[model samples]
Target: MTNTKKETRTVNIDIRKDLFGANENAAALNAETFKKHGIVAIDIMGSVGTGKTQLIETLCDHLRDKYRILMLAGDLATTIDADRVASHGVDTVQINTGTACHLDARMVRVALQNVNLADYQVIFIENVGNLICPAGYSLGVDRKLVVVSITEGPYMIRKHPLTIKHADMVIINKIDLVEALEFDIDALEADIREVDAAIPVLRVSSKTGEGIDQLIKVLNL
Candidate 1:
């Protein structure tokens, strides 16, 4: 018993769209709100255990007087990161995303209400520690900085292309662990160059205070 069916012709359709226009519009409004307040919001993206909070705290030490900084720390639960960062004498807002993966612009816009954005020169959103979902959404930020560690491996740049692609600056944190971890620093630098030729890579040891100054200079510029 052979059941044969006639071949059907296929039609090509050219359709372009953003499925969630509300999100896009809200992101635009979020940017407008940040600009109105003169806040340079930067979203920090990285994998889990990349030392994002520590690097940001270290940055606060140099940038405190230069700019009034506020941190919006996102996580699955708790205000622990926000609490820790606020101990450095800057305002911090914690957004518990529950089961969600990333922080979008609307989340940022809502969080801004807790603090006075006008008084701050920069707002840093320590996005949930995921390399993929965070890179797709804009948080009304002026810059997207990706943080990585030597301990993570020299090949992290290649594995997480979205973060590397969108990153304006990449912080290679935990340089103090390079020798102990047998990390290939030059190879890591080359990997970053291959992923993004224009983006700057910085090797910083928050514990020992190495290359921190250069980072500040880049931020100021």
Candidate 2:
């Protein structure tokens, strides 16, 4: 059961343009487009190997029966992530960002132009695998989620405070290996609290299916 209607889209993105200024304006327009169709969009960001794609796969597996879902995957090349999720019977759009580090609102609007927006109820955007750049751009989504894995080491939250500050929720993934890796989840959580006093944090393992239900509850999915 797969729908590869819109596999992956590659757009010519000019990074020389005013990224901040242009992106903000375009984000607002994208917001209007989403609201017109009553869609719930989420922007997922994290570093390489942080399991952004796997988390989306878990989410799609959980929500596919309840909602008409679409996944918009942004990557430098290849449609691997989009292909993986599309196998779950969720429609997907791939945004090949050429040289850009993040998926801007205009890129989303352009990728969505060929598809009918009213056909879907939820949109999950998998941004390029970079923590720093993606935090600065807004994709006009209902929430921006940042996933941090214990495999990245404990200093991630401290080193990238702005990324944590920008996200609506923080997901600590791969917690199933916490004891084996001697990783301290509490201290890392303290670091996030230092940056954002009230952001919701969930501990999850895409493999073991732990804490995913709590995360979905927080996301109102």
Candidate 2: 10-residue stretch with minimal lDDT: 12-21
Which one is best on TM-score?
2
Q: State how far residue 40 of model 1 sits from its true place (Å).
A: 1.4
On the 0 to 100 scale, the lDDT of residue 16 in model 2 is 50
**Highest lDDT, which number?**
2
Q: Which ten residues in a row have the lowest lDDT in candidate 1?
A: 13-22
lDDT to native, each model: 0.84, 0.93
Regions of candidate 2 where Cα sits further than 4 Å from its true position? 1-17
RMSD of each: 5.6, 12.7
Over 75-131, each residue of candidate 2 has an lDDT whose tens digit, in order, gives 999999999999989999999999998888899989999999889999999999998
TM-score of each: 0.88, 0.91
Candidate 1, residue 92: Cα displacement in angstroms equals 0.6
